[model samples]
Target chain A: MREKQIDKLKDYKYGFTTDIENIRAPKGLNKEVIEFISKAKKEPKWMLDWRMKAFERLKNLKEPNWQKPKYPKIDYQDIYYYSAPKSASDKPKSIDELDPKLLETYKKLGIPLQEQQRLNGIAVDAVFDSVSVATTFKDKLNEVGVIFCSISEAIQKHPELVKKYLGSVIPLTDHYFATLNSAVFTDGSFVYIPPGVRCPMELSTYFRINASQTGQFERTLIIADKGSYVSYLEGCTAPMRDENQLHAANVELVALDDAEIKYSTVQNWYPGDENGKGGIYNFVTKRGLCKGINSKISWTQVETGSAITWKYPSCILQGDNSIGEFYSIAITNNHQKADTGTKMIHLGKNTKSKIISKGISAGFSDMTYRGLVDISSKAKNSTNYTQCDSLLMGNKCGAHTVPYIKNKNPESNIAHEATTSKISEEQLHYCQQRGLNPEEAVGLIVNGFCKEVLQQLPMEFAVEAQKLVGISLEGSVG
Target chain B: MLKIKNLKADIDSKSILNNFNLEIKPGEVHAIMGPNGSGKSTLSNILSGKKGYNVSGEVLFENKNLFELETEERAHKGIFLAFQYPLEIPGVNTNIFLKTSLNAIRKANGEKELDAIEFLKLVKLKAKNLKFDEEKLNRQLNVGFSGGEKKKNEILQMSILNPKLSILDETDSGLDIDALKTVADGVNSLRKKDNSFLIITHYQRLLDYIKPDYVHVLMNGKIIKSGGPELALELENKGYENFN
Candidate 1:
């Protein structure tokens, strides 16, 4: 009788899609396809050359396969490298010129880009498939000297700004997936908060992958000049009809002197079916460089999607007294596998960093937290503190924590702590005795478990992330 | 307010409660004194709708079959089980937990939800009346609390929820004399014509304060003897072996 409650929780609400005509590259990857993508974007010669170098380097590079929870083998030549809606090329100046079908899809997701017509406090740049179809609140952001647009548009209009910082933080020869991403990334958001300017509203990009046969390679770059501050949010959702897709993204952030950048993401892509037939393979590499004194960068993420996830949003504290913070909550269920954490590399004097991670695994899924805090000899008097906690909801799930703390400086102070626990029957009974239903009790307890990381998210995103945590773990227990 | 007939419970094919029977009426406080593993805790667990146990019996609470309800449904029906070891849930504020619980019970009873201000007023008055520190209300539920404090929190919940039938399991096991008296006083203050309590303890120490009207001795999963309040003192002076 009680199993019916779990049956009702199996439905994924974000699986609906709209049928629209799409323009896609052929199902293969080669030098000619690379040329096709570059010519399609109408990029300058230098950008095309850069992509070619990355692709050439990718031929010799190998995918890192040493993670504790391994990912499936990916076929390199079987994916469509570039895809975009046929109407995406028009680049509508306003919402009226956009396709009604595309606008209706965004409306159903509560994106507010077409519904309110930019009447909200947040500006959204919506990316469909391989291109940015609609952007709102451009004029208002322009009034305050904030540049919020797609990466491709930034490369076209502000070439110098894009060229100066594109590969500065994450170079072309980074990891295998990042190198592949640099070669074929079609569209992602870009933001540049000018010097001494505090962004008026939070800049957000809503990414939706519609085409079934394409691989999504999104590249994002945000630069906060001296004494500027900006907060950016990114969200992604995919339809249920998945045939083992791949999403490889590269994000780079630069915070100059006295600047701060707060980046938060709530990613809910389509997980495979109950038996794990087909889902998205998400491999992302994100890094931020604190280049000037007293600069700060913080990354908060709530990951409850993707059948197999491997990413580590790292921070490089290269300036004196700079700070870095990472708060993450990764949940995997029903044959999912996630190997995610963060890296804090202290290179300057007295650089500080804190890492707090929470992982919940259920239903035969394996979750691993692999993190590193490296303190160089030159980073004298540096301080690093890390706390990683894991919770298991069922007997079949697995949770593992591997923390590496390398303190090379004699004057540095570093502390690492970890704990693994299961959701106890006592806690649930206590909640149920107070009149909370089973799922509500689970929600309450899971929220309490993830409170440390959830508080770091923005107010609106926090509420949404809290609900998503409960929904992601539903029916995975017992 | 509650009746049980032919209650049999087992775990892992081991019998715990076999043909156990009890009846509790409104406004009466009954005490069941038993030795270790005499099926005291199992009875409470079964009554509160805890899963993973083989139970066969008829349990009627207010003219309804108790076994037909879920744990939360049983709670909404005014049946509260104050656990022997109150679970500590860190990161969940005590005040918010109480408020959510109160509103849930109220909603189930067809009452309107209480806003923050009304909830604060009601909670403050109850906390003060129970001599509970107000600062604990903002902290996580029973986290880092002393043993006596945890028991007091349970009583505080019982007092505020005002359940029609309260089954407290070993509430006096770890309390000192003063704390024990406070717990008993909290229970006594909530007694009314429409409310009832079933106090289960290993000793008769707690019954001295709440003054249960009936005392029963359970052995080997069944009630071996039953009598009035005087039976408690008899067991207290001579120990449970005296009945044998």
Candidate 2:
């Protein structure tokens, strides 16, 4: 009887796909679809011209073959390039004025729409499918000379700022997915902190994919002026489905002299079913550039849900006395695959960087960590330290580490450490002997292993991320 | 309250406890003094249901077959083991862990769970009696704790759990005289007519504070001598060679 109950509780939640109405373009890539999208959004002439140039470049760019996973050829014309919330116009100004059904969807996902009245310390910009639905605390941010709005709105309001630094860190021809994002990106958040001003509250963007058979391509850019500081968080969740979804996003950060930027991400995409049928294909490109003297940038991410994840958020220290740090915790379970890490490029004197990555694999999942540390000839007295560790919970799972280090400056100091360990039966028994069940024991130990990374998150999101970790590994133990 | 008959155990195909037999009634404190490699720690581990040991035994606790039970089930049945080397669980506050463990044991025994106020009062009183600093209770469990402090924390847990049968595995190995006395006094305070203890040690210093009712000398793989509390004194003076 107990065995039957256990089997019943192990049923997958995302096994069923929703049959919703979808408006799709014809199966082929042509200039007609680009024109149709631009016309549909009623974009300006310059914007359309920019999209046309990006489209021409996308046609010539070749797919990248550096990643580990193998895949079939992508039919660009087969995918719907543009999707939006049903009944959405150009943009909505208020939550009540938005489509009632779209608001209901956000409510089901537990994102409070009236965030301005509910939370005073967090500024939220909610993006539904392909467009920004509502942005809260705009007036407060405007008073401090800070700009927090949608990328499209930023292009219209502050065109000079967007054109000056857009694609500076991540060029249009960086990679295959990045080129795709550069061409057909729909909407994402844009943040700009002024000089000598420390933002009083955290800024956040919550992304949700609602339409079926549609790909999500968003672009984010954050620029901190001299001596400014800001902390940003990005969270994403999609509806349960059985078909693989594509998400390609690009995020770039620029920190000027004496400025600091800390970015955190908690990704809970819909993972595939137990039989490995369908889930999200997450491919993202994120990088930060420390341009001014004594600047800093840090990235912290906790990835627990996805079918195939390929991402590397990196930092480039081009300023003297600058610092860079990356802390990541990635967990894969039940046929999931993840190959994620970071890169630190040092090009200035007295630069330093640190990387700590923890990967946990369970139930036949495959996980790996790949990172690079490069110190250029001009980077005298530069230093870097990296430690990557993997913990395997079951015998059937696999873990691997591949690190690349290239140094040219003789005065630089670099240290790298990597270790792979398994959860011994003895440790589990010890915890179980203290009255903890097997699932709880595994959760405790895994949490302990990832404490160094989880502590890097902001206080508010750290609690939520920790709970998500426990929930993600609910039945993977037994 | 506990019985072992014809207990044969091995680790990695090497025999540790061969044909061992022992029994302890309620309200009695039994000290098992043994030399190195005598399997005193193995007995404690097997009683607490630790894995990785192949065993052929008939062990009964409170009239229930112990081998059929999981480690947690055995713990729920009022059996506690103080590890010789306590693990350091980072990011888990000591107070929170102690309260969670106490409440789990309570809920398993068909008792109501304690609220924050009650748990705080109980733990504060126990911590004060054991001379545990209030600040240490707020930090991560056993992370960066001194050797003496870890032992004191084990006693703090034993006190809060209030188990019917407690097994101490080398609890006094790294403790000084003052900490050893405090730990023993804490154990003596928890003694009741319905509870028992099985203390495993290499020396008789801890027995000086909490006098034992029975002493057993173990050699190789079995107990070779048994006597009253005076046997501990004799063993401390003479050593295990005399028993052999």
Q: Highest DockQ, which number?
A: 1
The best candidate in terms of TM-score:
1
Task: Please report the TM-score between candidate 1 and the true structure.
Answer: 0.95
Q: By TM-score, how accurate is candidate 2?
A: 0.91
- In candidate 2, which residue ranges exceed 4 Å CA deviation? A1-28, A115-117, B5-21, B90-96, B106-125, B133-140, B143-146, B217-227, B231-244
lDDT of 1: 0.89
Question: lDDT per residue, candidate 2, A181-205, as tens digits?
Answer: 8777777899999999898888988
The TM-scores, one per candidate, come to: 0.95, 0.91
* Chain B TM-score against the true chain B, candidate 2: 0.98
lDDT of 1 by residue, A1-478 (tens): 2433447337777787779888777778777888888877888888888899999999999988888766557888899988888887768788778998988898888785664555367889899888888778888889989999999889888899999999898999887999999898889989999999999998899988888868999999999999999999999988887488889999999999999999998988888877876778888999999998889999999999888888999999999999999999999989888999999999989899999999999888899999999999999999999999999987888999988889899999999989898889888888898898777778888888899999998787788899999999887654
TM-score of A-chain in each prediction? 0.97, 0.94
